[model samples]
Target: MSRELDLKSEKSIEDLKKLSKEELIIKILELEKLRINKNELVNEGKKIKRVFDFTKCQKRHVAFKLLYLGWDYQGFAKQDDTEKTIEHELFHALTKCCLIESRQTSNYHRCGRTDKGVSSFSQVISLTVRSNGNNSKELNYCKMLNRLLPKDIRVIAWSPVIDNFSARFDCTSRTYKYWFPRGNLDIDIMNNAVQHVVGTHDFRNLCKMDVANGVTNFTRRIISANVKLCSNNDQFSKSRGYDMCELTIVGQAFLWHQIRCIVAVLVLIGQHKENECVITNLLNIDNCPRKPQYSLASDLPLNLFYCQFENVNWIIDNESVTEVISTLQHNWASHMIKTTMLGEMLKNIEDLVPDSINKQSDCLLQGVKSKIYQPLMKRPASESLENRIKHYTKKGRLKIENNEKN
Candidate 1:
């Protein structure tokens, strides 16, 4: 078809002067219609994909954030390249189980992009599926997807969000926490420094700017943030145990790597290694965007603590979802027992301590001497880097400082 168009286009402009602009537009529209119909004809599927005659219109759809453990799989969102992501897994489940096809036609929009080895507890997405989905259908969709889904990912709960309930824009806030080991950390000083992150400020210095999509905005509101020596998930551990410490931050959305950048600063301040004004220095009104000097915290330890949706009742559920939860409890008990057995049986397995874990090394004395202090223990993660020059350059422009450089 393109070859035919090339032949037609080869005619001299003077020779083709007979055709008017309106005639050219009509020809183009006609060609576009032909191409669309041809493509549709070629892609016509055999099952529920062709259930609706798209010529008429589309059915109602619903969207939700699909949380997944990206450690073993791919990223959070789906892509054309076909690495297994939460979106891809859900896509397969939708087609094979829920009988929905075509994310492009379905009008799906994910909230954010998370990298490999990252995980989210509250990742949000907008999608339109058959919205008349009743509990029976919903349960069926959940169960069927869970059956095929890898153990790491699960659709814990879903609510019927309003048409105006945008996962990104309408969000009230977003919170993230970076878990760090309790070893030699000055929790009091870190907690005091967290107070500075509460107010609205220039966060360019505290974030590794992501210029990939031309994003240079660095101002974000940090409504509340704090640091604490988190003990454990169980109440008994929280009450009597002195294990598992972490730094938690909650805010109304965040810039790329902002939490981790802030985490590094807090860590420094907590140790009295950096002055308190470091937070205030970055927040200077005259200061512009700048690249983050701190490296990003590990991915696995960071979790998407929660996503705030205004007035969207996220807890709507009945007996079916309850049953699913109960089933999950059962599965977890079984899996835990199996994992315990495996740990004991596979004694040869090398345990590489994560960044936030416990350590017996002389990190305290060494840390005071070395600017780069890495304790010899692994820790957990919460919601979770980059170039030095390019990062600061963009931020400088946003700050309207040193326009002569650019």
Candidate 2:
């Protein structure tokens, strides 16, 4: 009987080999189903799935240093309406890997909340997560998380910290860089204008007032602000609208849309549409009680460059660092190829155009460019801060007390 069964199986294999690809696939699927049913009968009962026991694992509070290309993401913070966000991906990877039970139980805090299309090289987040025995024996966080996270978002490094440390409150400073092409822009005047922004001032007129969110305070300390050429090998004569420059602003904290708003005004100054003192003039709320209506700079070129922290020692995994470098190099090469191709096409087209034609200004600013430019002071303004406060208060978003908003 055993010899006859072996012969029959051999004959079946030979028959399958002669079948077409589709017929073979159908036969394979039928075999798989038969194997599954046979296993179920062999077990005599359904197998119970095991749950991960959090009680048996040790936990540690740590901060993760992250980098992301945010062009495709909604934003850094998660939203109730959409899951296409960095924070959403982070928590998804965490829970999927069983690193933490949930975001609420993880004691999570982000260092900075970047807007949509804004990339970051040094975004940080503090959270409590499952751990191994000790520092030397800890699980490979970068490797584990990177395996599950999308290619654009990466966990570069992590560090253990004190129990009371918060990524948001403990951060000493943040540096933002806005990149733009130097298209007939007066870099000297733009640099001079940015100097006026490098001190403490009431910036309510330069930012969008979020009265409904209870963010009435607009005073923020700027450590530094300037515009400089991003490349060292560039000459003014050879620029031809391809030379890139950056507006760098370092501050302790920033209000919503603050950096973008500042960049828009500085671009106006660079283009000779506004004087350098427009920065200082906007800072004085007594003179300009309402913010002038203006479009913000595009979010694509903005980057969170650095986040300053004190007294925390970051642990760099050599293997993980190597892997991250490799991944970044691959991404850089791909982008560089595309950029070079576009540059070649642009150069070819420029030869056909007349030199007398004026070079176009920055296209990264949001909204349509008007044929007739209006000065910043002459533009229509938003409602006054006091009026916005009153409106939100009437809507029950804020409470007033003793003639002051509480």
| RMSD of each candidate relative to the true structure | 13.4, 9.3
Candidate 2, 179-265: lDDT as tens digits:
888777888899999999888998888777777777777888899998998863233344456678888999998888889899999
Pick out the ten consecutive residues of candidate 1 with the lowest summed lDDT. Answer: 376-385
Q: How many clashing pairs does model 1 include?
A: 21
TM-score, cand. 2 vs. native: 0.85
TM-score each candidate.
0.63, 0.85
Each prediction's whole-model lDDT (CA): 0.59, 0.86
Instruction: State the lDDT of candidate 1 residue by residue for 230-295, as single tens digits.
Output: 754242221222235676777777776676567666656766667666787666636423442344
Looking at candidate 2, what is the lDDT of residue 216? 77
Lowest lDDT 10-residue stretch of candidate 2: 397-406
